[model samples]
Target chain A: MASLIFQIVVDSLLLGGVYTLMAVGLSLAFGVTRIINFAHGDIVMYGAYAAFFAFVSLNIDPLLSLLFVAILGAIGGYLLFKLTLDRILDAPGINQVLLTFGLGLVLQNVAVILWTGDERSTTPSYAFDSWFLSDDIVVAKGRLIAFGLAVAFVVLLLAWLRWSELGRATRAVSQNRAAASLMGINVRAMYALSFGLSSSFGTATGAIMSFLLPITPFMGFPILVKAFAIIILGGLDSIVGTVIGAFLLATAETTIAYVVPQGIGWAEGVAFFLLVIVLIVRPTGILGTVGRDA
Target chain B: MNLSRTSVMVALSVFAAVISPAPSRAEDTIKIGAPLSLSGKFVSYGAAAKRGVEMAVDIYGGKVGNKKIEILFRDTQSDPQVAVNSFTQLLSEEKVNFLIGPIATPMAMAGLPAWRRTRALWVVPGATTPLLEEEAGKEPMLFHTFPYGYYYHLALARSLREKLGPGKTVAIIYSDDAYGREHLPYAQKYFTQEGFKIVAEELVRAGATDLNPVLAKIRRVKPDLLLGLVQTTDGIQLTKQVYVQRLNIPYLVGTAYPQLKQWQDASGEAQEGWVGVTTYIPGLKAKADPKYPKLFMDSDVWKAEFTKRYNREPEFIDVGAYVSTCMLLIAIENAGAVDDKEKVAEELKKLDVHTMIGRGHFEPSLGGTLNQAFADVVVHQRVKGADAILYPKEFETADKFEQATYAK
Candidate 1:
């Protein structure tokens, strides 16, 4: 029983790593823009599809194609932000939400139109090849690699946000756009950068996911939901809260899954249960008190 | 000439056109409505069936037995209400004498009642519910060019029971909708008779993701086998969670209708040794029936023509719709009239149509009075990156049927 609990923790941590990668991108976009990008999940899905196309068409390895996918995603984010998001920056919350929601639908439909809504997954050589720690427990090599990359990306992102001039500018705009403008920060460029960086994060997650799972055009919807749950649990404005929230949800969900009779359904239900608990107990969420924006 | 007299003359002319025996242009053209999902989840299936129909049309030079066939495509969006609306447009507005389907089972079921009022000849390829046959019994025009869900799912149960002895625990995660509900009764009936314990039965909302919760339930059950009777997206997500959770159950099976390349890519190595049952496999029994395989596989007819016309590899659902359309052609030609829906439906019941899958013979059975076509299915398992037929002994080209032994 102790060993089983240990196993669940290990599994949840690894799974949480992937969740962290997926959730952080949404958090960054929402943190800076104060607009919930419903298109974030589909953006990740598009990244995976772009990588899958490259992998299938050119035989390029999925891992190696991350740079290309990220760049493409960044460019797409820039163009979409310029055309749609830039206009709605100061709009009401509901309008901003509707804009991104409609944009997500368009992106999903565009993928369907082009690829016919067919399921596509990268046929990576090492996808299922995993090392067994013991006779009963095995860890997939692809996921482990993905976890390493996710950690490294998160570390690099934190360093940039803390140390780099661009990161400081982004943080300033997110913290106080009017004040940042008075202090000579190009708030417009900062919003673009934040959105672009978030896209890069989304692309990275997609690149990892496509090699691990079959990606369809509609895959974005669930991922979008999870990101929302994580952002809410982590405190929408808190980056550190996002990371903590991802782990909390992953661990609780995974642990409950094993203990509960109907684990899978229970786990999914628990996300909302957690949301309610957080709202009632500590409305600001775990680690959300420091600099939470409305 | 007074205005009232002119109006009366125009009304008379319109009435005469409706009552006229002659077709608009030539005695040749036969119009069939194909209400299929051109968007959403079932798009690939719809697209593939469309390709198969296009091929059939070209091979017959767009004519069957002195009549030129015109296929009108209507998108269903994989929604039941949308399908009903599409069928209404096809039947009442466009006035197609014959109808092909919306691919998914529920959409087909919902759209079925519309056909009753119009009394049009409707042939469905991908929607494979036994309930359809029952529904058709009340209104006999509904014809299916697909296998019943019970028959196909039974093959999976039989294979599993024989391959893995008795007393084993089986976990199932299925969609809590019509598609899953249709097959679950039959699965439960057979699996229980076979002496396997259903340890866990989890239901997922249609189009829901985050299969981790469901996976957690299955893992807790500690079943020897995990079975998924889910749609493509949920199936894919479940398979990933299984692999990620490292649940090493002996047999992991999925409902493998409308074979998508997504399963193989998504499940990857985890999909290895995964057992599934499907109705159509291009060249599986080609050696025994060389002509059947030759017509479906070796001929670049569909590939060349589809690429030339639509620029894509025809999906399985598209092929289904295409076959349904071709069957409509055979019926209309045999009936020898463009306007008679009942007569066309009667002719369709009598006709034996050969499709990409195999020979289809519609015979009146348990489901209804008019014979609904059923596809002969083979139990297939993935072995070393390729799908190999395992059951019925006749189609076994693989080395052996290896039973999955539980590891403690």
Candidate 2:
């Protein structure tokens, strides 16, 4: 029983790392842009496909190709921002959501058209290779590498937000675009830059994930939902909240999914159940203040 | 000016050449629409099915009975709404007379009404839930390429009950939603009738990645044999979790598309000794000629061809898809026309086609008079270094499967 519990913890934490990365990217974009990019998952999916193509054609290792994936994501997000986000700056929230939703559909279809709609998985040399901590518990090298990268990216992002002028401008634009512009911040450039950065992180996550698990175009929907839940749970505007939300939700889901005695199907329902309880008990989330709009 | 005009003419001709292939279907060409899940959860089904369809069409020189046979493919994305929309677009817009699939059951079910309204023949290559046939009823235009879901579960139940005896407790873990609901009644009925005690039955959702919670519950029940009809992702996760948890039993069986290669690749030796009841083999080596069914074991062409083509041995699902397209082509040939829905429907009911699986024939038995007669269910296991077929002594390629040690 103890060993089983331990194994469950390891599995949940590893799975949680992917969720955290996805949620953090969504939270970052939502915080700064105040336009929830419903297509964030699609962006991640595009990165995954990009990485897959790179792996297949160029024979590049998926892990090492994260930089290339990030670049592609930046280009994609920049183009999407220029093409769609610029037009929707003053549109209704519902319209913004629809626009992104349409973009998601378009991206998914494009992938299907180009990639032939096949479920692709990177046969990373490290995918099957694992390091054993003990007899009962083991960490897959791909996932272990992904976890480290996720934590490192989150830290680096936090540092940038705290220390960088661009990050400060982004935060200002997120809090109040008019005020940021009045204060001489390049609000337009900031919005596009923030979106680009968010997409870059999202792509990196997908590339890392491709190494850890299978990458299919359909996986975007589930990841999108999880990220939405995490951002909401962590308080949409709070970076600290996003981080906390990612860890908390990942831990809660992983633990309950492992220990709840029903199976992982029960784990899916756990997110919604947790969402309800968190909303009722602490609407601002674990890290959000009373005034925070989660 | 002359050079520029000549260049313009060349570009126009090139563009025309590229664009004109769309309308060039030969008078004898058979056009079939396949709205399979090219993207989304069941993408592999579409991918593998497309591969088989392409292979079949290639072998047939992309024609049937001197007519060029063309498959109009659409991506359903595995959502019923998407499938319905695709079907609407395909039927109302593209005017395809014959339909091949929406691989999953629910999508197939939703698309059926549209096909029924149009009076078009639906010879689906995949999606075998009983609800499809149950609802189709007297609609003779519907034919299933895969065996009924109930037939598969029944095969598992009967084989296990007969081999292991009725006294052993049977436990099943299935999907919680409509897919699972469709099979519950039939599974319960068969288990009771077969005299095996239903020790425990659990439901798991489609999108779940962890099975530790359910596995915990299942372990608490501690039944002799375990059966699962789970989604591919859940199945892969569960199989790995079971190994990590070191839960061992006499038998563990799974239904649905469990990527055996992925599972084994992830879990290694732990994934050994697992058994599944499937309609096709991703890597089964069978002779080209059905006359010497036994010769599949010795056919280097079968092994070499499958390996060279697929980069892995063919799973039963691959064969299932291959056989499905075979049936579709046979119907096309028999009808002598693809655009005549009525004739295509008529031809389908009279089909007696030879496939990689076995000899299959459809009769006027169910929806659209397409009663399928292929009843043999083969049990496959990953034994040692290869996938060994264990059912029907004549087709037996390896000795009986033995258990591998749990990998924890």
DockQ of each: 0.35, 0.26
lDDT of 1 by residue, A243-282 (tens): 8988888888777766776565567678689888987887
Per-candidate Cα lDDT values, in order, are 0.73, 0.71
Residues B172-289, candidate 2, lDDT per residue (tens digit)? 8888766776777777887778887888887777766445466656776767777777656556655655655555566777765443555554344445667776665544444455
Question: For residues B1-408, could you state the per-residue lDDT of candidate 1 as single tens digits?
Answer: 557988999999999999988755645667878887878877777767667666767755677666667888888888788888998898899887777766677777778778777777777776766667666654567677777777766777777777676798888777866777777877787787788888888876655434545654466668887778777766666666576566767777777732556666666655666677776553354222243333344324544555577775544455555556656666666777565788887777776645555565777644453656655667777767777777756666664444322222
Query: Taking the tens digit of each residue's C-alpha lDDT, what string does model 2 give over A1-294?
Result: 787778777776777676788888888888888888999998888888778778878989888898989988888888889889889889888999999999998888777667654445666656655666675466666666777887898899889987998888887887788899999998888889988988999898888767544566676888899899988888887777877777777678767666555545556567778878998888877765534533
Give the lDDT of residue B262 in candidate 2: 51
Model 2, residue B40: C-alpha shift (Å) = 4.6
Which candidate has the highest TM-score of all? 1
Poorest 10 consecutive residues by lDDT, candidate 2 chain B: B291-300
Model 1 residue A273 CA deviation in Å: 2.5
The 10 consecutive residues of candidate 1 chain B with the worst lDDT sum are B286-295
